[model samples]
Each structure stands twice: as C-alpha cells, then as structure tokens.
Target: MSLLLERHGQCLCGAVQLDCRLDNSDVSACHCQTCRRWGGGPLLAVECAQPPVIGGGDALGIHASSDWAERGFCIHCGTHLFYRLKAEPHYAIPVGLLEGEDWSLASEVFIEEKPAWYCFANQTRQLTGAELFAEHGQPDDA
Candidate 1:
C-alpha cells in the first residue's frame, strides 16, 4: 500500500470507527499467549506508524497488558482494536478490521508459543519469543 493510502474501518457493532494511513500491505501474525487468549488464535495485523484516528472515544477501551504495551478494543462489541507499544506512536491493527483490504502475511512472531492444532499455509519469516524480544526490545519483565 502507498503511504498516502488511507483506510477506514469499524467494530462489529459499528460503535467505533478508525481512520488511518497504511504503512504497508504486509501483515504479521503474533502467536504470543496474550494475543491468543485475547482473540482465540493468532493476531494477524499490520503495523501503522501512527495511531489511527479513533471515533466514539467512549466506546473504546484500553488494557495495559504489559508495561511496554497495551491492547485496545471496542467496549460495546469487545472487538480487538490494536496492539500499541507504550513508548511509540505505532499500532498493530487487526487485518480483519480493515475491511476490503488485501494483506499478505509477511511474518509470524512468538512462533514457539503457537499451538500445533492449527498452522498457516503462508510461507513467511518466523520468529521465536526470544528473537521477538531481542528485535523489538523486551517487555519490562524480560
């Protein structure tokens, strides 16, 4: 996607809407425990350089899952919104939320934590938990 391309999306209930520019068309999957528990599987998302413009502020909820990161969701519909790094302006938004956009899997993180019951057919770079922390900086506890 071009840097100038903007996308719009909303939660299941349409109580919250997002407007943001696409930093790339490549999507990444996170199989970390937190992500899996949050969404029932891996989180397939695209990183946005800037936080999306959030509509219906009152319908948005944020949970600080770790000292260095937080998860956002729609309060009304409980739709996972994004995973945000506390020290940065970036956001990893769920690809499913960006309706009508085609995103290709580029990578997968926390590969070691992924369950064996399911797997992706995509051939993408995979990173273990240790590698993810090393590359992105560990959470406070790490």
Candidate 2:
C-alpha cells in the first residue's frame, strides 16, 4: 500500500469536518483507560501526517485530557473528534471519523489496560502502557 492516503470525514451532525493525509491505513486501537472512558470503548487511532483542515463554525470542542494530549469532539453532536498532543501538530483521530479504504487492525496500544470483557481475533502488535510511555514518553512528557 502507499505510504499516504487522503481522507475526508465529519462529525455525526456534520457540524465538524476534516481533511487530512494519513500515513497508516491500518487502524490501531488504544486501550488506555482515558481513551476507553472518553469513547466508551477502545479508541481506534489513525495518525495524521500533518495538521488536518478542520472546518465548521463553533462545532468543535477541545478538552485537555492530559498534560501532553488534548481530546476534541463535536459540540453539536457530541461525536469524538480527535486525540492530539499539545506540543505536536499531528493528530491521532478516531478511525471511525475518517472515510477511507484498506483499513485493518494493525496494532493495539496500552494492552495492559485492556479489559478482558472483549478481545479482537486479529493477531496484532500489542504494547503495554509502560511500553507506550517508553516509546512516546510518559503522559506528562509524551
């Protein structure tokens, strides 16, 4: 598959829209507690290559979820929009928010925090919470 793919998507109420180029077509899932609580399940993460073009008026709501990251949603529809680092321009968006092709489960982050109630059958690269922090830096620094 190509390294990058263009995609467009919007919130449930069409209040917020985004255009972006993504490097990974495979959608990764985040099992971190914050992600689980925020979205009511594992957060399907699709990282953007750069800042996305988000349009619409007064429809975006941003919450500083952590010292290093902030979460966004649609103010009108309450749809989860994105999870982005405060110091970085890139965004790790919910895979469900973007329209594209060739999507598959590639990896799972914060595997250690994943509850036993549900599990995916796909064999994927799994990383523990500490491992994620080790690679991306702790939540305070990541």
Best by lDDT: 1
lDDT of 1 by residue, 1-142 (tens): 4455578888999999998787668899999999999998999998876789999999999999988889999999999998998876879999898865567899999999899999999999999988877777775245
How many backbone clashes does every candidate have?
Answer: 0, 0
lDDT of each: 0.87, 0.86
Regions of candidate 2 where Cα sits further than 4 Å from its true position:
1-3, 139-142
Please, what are the lDDT tens digits per residue for candidate 2 over residues 110-136? 898899999999999998877877766
Q: TM-score of every model?
A: 0.91, 0.91
Q: Report model 1's TM-score to 2 decimal places.
A: 0.91
User: CA RMSD for every model?
Assistant: 1.9, 2.0
